[model samples]
Target: MSNPKPRIALIGECMIELQQRADGSLLQSFGGDTLNTAVYLSRALGDSGAVDYVTALGDDSFSDAMCERWAEENIGLQRVQRLPGRLPGLYCIQTDAAGERRFLYWRNEAAVRECFTTPAAGPILAALPDYDVLYFSGVTLAVLGEQGRGKLLETLVEARRRGAQVVFDNNFRPRLWASIEAARVAYRSVLPYVELALLTVEDEQALFGHADSEAVFAAYAQLGTPEVVLKRGAEACLIRCDGQSYEVPAVRVEHVVDTTAAGDSFSAAYLASRLLGGSPVEAAEAGHRLASRVIQVPGALIPKD
Candidate 1:
């Protein structure tokens, strides 16, 4: 008989999103780095695997709506914590004529900040290692703060020790960090435990000061990360998996409406394909195809009719 469906848990924050239209109207929604990945991954995997989101939220209406949306997408929220009297974070997206996007955040007091540090988070942390895969991003690290991060690192160590593969996305946002060195130290502390690393070329350069792609791969090689993918917008993505390298070009799109969630969507498809036993090259192609379509849409999540 075939193996049982893989159980994966994604840890991060989900925010109330505002997408600014050309007419300056704001389209309200919910999105976040790992949450976007969770939605897309659930859509991609269907009944092939189980996807759970691990985070903290408020008991407010917005949080209620977010959970409703996740349920519609078939993402498991068993690990979600509803902290009394707290609130979810918020962000706004502004797009340029070139379809590139910028963000303004109002997430300092979000309940996810207490995700791993709070007493209520203990049970969730203890249960994380039971999953087949544990996924998170740099944004997850930034929001977790020092104490929460310490708790998270301990959980990751225990999770990996129990045979759970750890997946990481270096979705670096400089503004979220107190300083460059602090970010570096946090990342270094977790890098050795990662089994797979999904990285963007620009974010890698900005965060690690790597001059080029070769340097980025060389650094990850030192960390003994077995699988590494470098995502470059509009350019071919590079993959170094199982001691081999491959370059897969992105699908060309003539008219890009909005570039929101491009990387997050790509990461989701890539991880999904890999979990489904696709080769690295095939996974890269799958990621590019999904990301190309996402950039042509207006929001982080496309309608799932």
Candidate 2:
């Protein structure tokens, strides 16, 4: 008999994105870290596993377009809750003359902020333990508030105990958290339950003030996670698995049109390859292949064709 396909659920928000151009105009699209990862994971896995996006959105035109886009990508949207009279968040990206990007947000009242507090959230939380894999990120944790984080931590523990793998991405954004201490506490609470961790070395250093890669590796090793992948933009990635370490070089891109979802896409492809029974080295290669292509495009998702 063939083995059953794994079910993976990614929990996070996707907002309306405005990419500012040099001509003073904005190109509109939709993206978020976990959402980007979800789309890429679904694409990489194809029919090998089921991929779902777990979040709340408003019943607005933008929400409709977002759902349509996700559907076109063959991602499962059953876990996405639509809230009445609430709208999705919006943000604009501004790039300097040198092409470095900065983000301006207007999302304080977005619908996803209430995603885990509503009556419908009870079922969603309960359903989480049943999935083969549950993936979330630091941004997801920061946006969920203290009460929601506690509930989520409890759910993760239960899900792990019941044989589900919990994957975490450390997408640390300092502006999102009130203080460094709070982010540290929240991250520490989730570390013990994480089976696989996708970390960006720069973000990790900013959050924990790690002196170097060895310090970062030592910290994650103490957490007792079986696998850890450290991403360094434009450089090689570091992988630590089963007490063995490997340095995987990133695929070089001739031109980088945009770096919006580079790390997120890499994490998605890496995890998808692993779920399909590929080795860590093979998964890392797959990740680099995808991310190398992603950075060459102008947005979070590149055209599959």
Candidate 3:
């Protein structure tokens, strides 16, 4: 008999997004790292697996619109929290002539910061361990603060104990933490529980100062993570799976439009491929295929076909 559809939950913040055009006009929308993954994962998986976005949002219109968009993608919304009187975070993306983008954030008072602190969070925390796969990123850890990070770590422990596969992405943003030491402490604490790690070579170098991809792979090896993928922009991605390593070249894209959500999109396709029984090489190819198409678009989410 075929296996039942795996229940996958992606935990992170979804912010109100603004895209700054070259003529200085701002287009409003919504996107986040994990939210990008959730959307693309839903698109790639279709009805093959269950995908959910777990985060808190305000009762405001922006939050309402974010919900509508996710639901339109067929992503699960049962665990989403609507906090009273709070607001979703906002960010603006500016792209250079080369299509490389930078962000300016005004997210200090976002509702997701209180995601794990509210009284309503108790049941949400309790329900997390029942998932078949739990995915989160370094941004998820950074935004959670110390207490929330501790709580999330504890939940990861319990979830793994219940046989959930823990997937982590090291999408490290230096501006999010008080100190590199603090980020290191938090990342180290969660590393052992991770079964699959999706790492960006540059982010790993920025955070832990891994001199090269070898050092990054060696570190994850020490942590005993069974699967690891190192993504390098416009270069080959390195993968270690099932006690062997594979180097897969990225799909070439001419005239890159926006590099936003490139890694997020890759993670979505990679995880979807793996969950659907594709081999590691096949999964990396799937990741490259999706991400190549994403960067040629304008926003974190491209228009559905």
Candidate 4:
């Protein structure tokens, strides 16, 4: 019989998103890095695997709506925590003529910042190791702060010891970090426990000061990470697995709508393919295909059909 479907838990924040229209109107939606990945992963997996989102939200209407949306997408919500009075963070997305997007965030005081600090967090953190895979990102590290990050580190140690695969996406947003050095230190602390690292070369260069993709791969090699995938925009994505390397070119899109969640969509499809036994090259190709479709749409998500 085939192996049982893997259970994956993605940890991070989901924010209220406002997309700017050409006519200067705002379209409201919900999105975040790990949340976007969770949604896409669930869609890609269908009934083959399970995807759970682990985060703290508020008891506000927006948080309620976010959970409702996730349920509609078939993402598991047992790990979500709701705190009274606090609300989800908000952000606005603006896209240029080239389909490139910029964001303005009001997430500094989001409820998820205290995700690992509250009394309810102990049980949640303890349960993370039971999942087949645990996923988080640089934004998760930044938003969690020092104290929360310490708790996350402890949980990661336990989770790795329990044989759960830890996956990280180095989605580096310099503005979220206190300083370059602090970010470096936090990233280094988490690297030793990661099983698979999904990285963006540009983010690597900005965060760890790596010269290029080779430098980034070399750095990960030294960390003894077993599998690594490096995504380069509109170029071939490189993968290092089982001591072999493969390069997969991205699918070209004729018309780009919005570039929001492009990397998240790629990461989601890549991880979904990997979990479902796709080869590294196949997984990379899958990532590119999904990302190309996502960029042709307006928001972080597209129609299910």
**lDDT leader:** 1
Worst 10 residues of 4 by lDDT: 1-10
Cα deviation in Å at residue 236, candidate 1?
A: 0.5
- Score every model by TM-score: 0.98, 0.97, 0.98, 0.98
C-alpha-based local distance difference test score of model 3: 0.92
lDDT of 1 by residue, 1-305 (tens): 01258899999999999999989999999999999999999999999999999999999999999999999999998999999999999999999999988899999999999998778888999999988999999999999999999998999999989999999999999999999999999999999999999998789999999999999999999999999999998999999997999999999999999988899999989999988888898889999999999999998998875
The lDDT of model 2 is: 0.90
lDDT of 2 by residue, 131-159 (tens): 99999999899888888788789999999
Flag regions of model 3 displaced more than 4 Å.
1-3
RMSD of each: 1.4, 1.7, 1.3, 1.3
Local distance difference test, per candidate?
0.93, 0.90, 0.92, 0.92
Whole-model alpha-carbon lDDT for candidate 4: 0.92
What is candidate 1's local distance difference test score?
0.93
lDDT of 3 by residue, 1-305 (tens): 01268889999999998999989999998899999999999998898989988899999989999999999999999989999899999999999988999999999899989888889989999999999999999999998889889889999999989999999999998899999999999999999999999999889999998999999999989889999999887898999986899999999998999999999999999999999888888999999999999999998999987
Q: Count the backbone clashes (under 3 Å) in each candidate.
A: 0, 0, 0, 0
Which residues of candidate 1, in runs, are more than 4 Å off?
A: 1-3
Which lDDT tens digits does candidate 4 get at residues 182-297?
99999999999998899988899998789988898899999999999998878889999878999999998889999888899999999988888888988899999999999999
